[model samples]
Target: MSAVTIRAARPEDAGTVLELTRALARFIKAEDWFLATLADVERDCFGEAPRYEAWLAEVKGASAGLATLFPTYSTFKAKPCLFVDSLYVDETARGYGVGKVLMRHICQLAVERGCVRVDLNVLNWNPARSFYTGLGMQETGELGMTITGPAMRSLAGLD
Candidate 1:
């Protein structure tokens, strides 16, 4: 396994980050929804009022993986939580501890921000579930539901 270094992502990393995200979408069988481009990543992660924060994993000074986190509210906990919006490791870099290093840094950031917990959703078919479980993340056993597109439009009376 190669040594993996994790650090906060910069605008310059947008291109590689988009590539890794697409690769991850392919791995999770959701390539159809992998529509992000370098411009989008750069704007969303580094523009004014940034929507999220990202961490990148590098091996021998080359990007090997990345993770994006969004700030979320936990009403019950009455505090903020960190939601791992996306995580990806390059195919060639899997099993080299890149993913773990990225996750550790995210977790450390969550702690530093005084977040009550860190949360993420994993695909049922993804083998990384075990890795998260090993890191003390437990299944909530609660079904997730979402309303997007037209449903959201109708709810908001915009349609």
Candidate 2:
């Protein structure tokens, strides 16, 4: 495996980022939930109002993986944080430290931005939990709660 290079993603890399995202979704058995397309990725990640920033991992000049991050606020800390929206590595590039490089790059960016912390969510059954844990991310001991679809509609008085 070649040395993986991590850098901020450019506009031209949007398509590649989307491809990696789909590949990751498939790897995690959530291909059905993969809803992003090149158009969406380009618009949201590289458009004038860019909703997120991305970092790419290149191995021997080929895209190996990517990590997308969005700005978030920590009410308690009264500071900004980064939410890692997605991190994915190509199947062929897995276990070669591509993900680790991407993660470290993301952490470095967070620190550079003076963020209070970086946060990400992983499926409970995900095998990658160990990897995140090893990176010093502790389990908060609080289950994630959500209200969506009809539940959210009813709560919002829209149903």
Candidate 3:
């Protein structure tokens, strides 16, 4: 395999990113939950005020993987942290270290931005848990939680 190159995704790459996103959803058997559109990707990732940043991995000039992340504050540390929204490698690109390269790129970005930490959540059943552990990531012991859909609306008094 050729050396994988990682680059900040350009607006032109939005479709490729969205395609990989769907592939990831399919891989995780969550196709029904995948709902992002090209417009969403374009606006959120490449707009004037990007909600997040994305990087793409390419091997031999072909798209292979992607990672999306955003910054957040850690009041305790009084510094910024990066939360990885997703890290996915195409099936054809697995075992070629694409995921590891992307993760290292995220960490490198954190360091450059003076971030205190980098965080991400992986499903308990995901085989990538071991991959993260291998990179020295440890379980924080805090349960992940979320509120969405009608429940989210009710919390915001929109019900």
The prediction achieving the highest TM-score against the true structure is: 3
Candidate 3's error at 24, in angstroms? 1.5
**Could you tell me how far off, in angstroms, the CA of residue 30 lies in candidate 2 after the best superposition?**
1.9
Reference-based lDDT, residue 71, model 3: 98
Which whole-number lDDT from 0 to 100 does residue 21 have in model 1?
A: 83
Better of 1 and 3 by TM-score: 3
Runs off by more than 4 Å, candidate 1:
none
Whole-model Cα lDDT per candidate?
0.87, 0.89, 0.95
Candidate 3: deviation at residue 107, Å?
A: 0.5
Query: What lDDT score goes with residue 140 in model 3?
Result: 97
Question: TM-score of every model?
Answer: 0.93, 0.93, 0.97
Poorly placed runs, candidate 2 (over 4 Å) = none
- Write one digit per residue (lDDT tens) for candidate 2, span 1-159: 989999888889888888888888887898987889889989999999999988899999988888989999999999899999888888789999998988888888889998999999888999899999988998888887777788999989998
Per-candidate alpha-carbon RMSD to the true structure: 1.4, 1.4, 0.8
Worst 10 residues of 1 by lDDT: 12-21
Span of ten consecutive residues with least summed lDDT in model 3:
21-30
Q: Show pairs that collide, candidate 3.
A: none
In Å, residue 92's CA in model 1 sits off its true spot by 1.0
- 114 Cα displacement, candidate 2 (Å): 0.6
| Error in Å for residue 40 of model 1 | 1.3
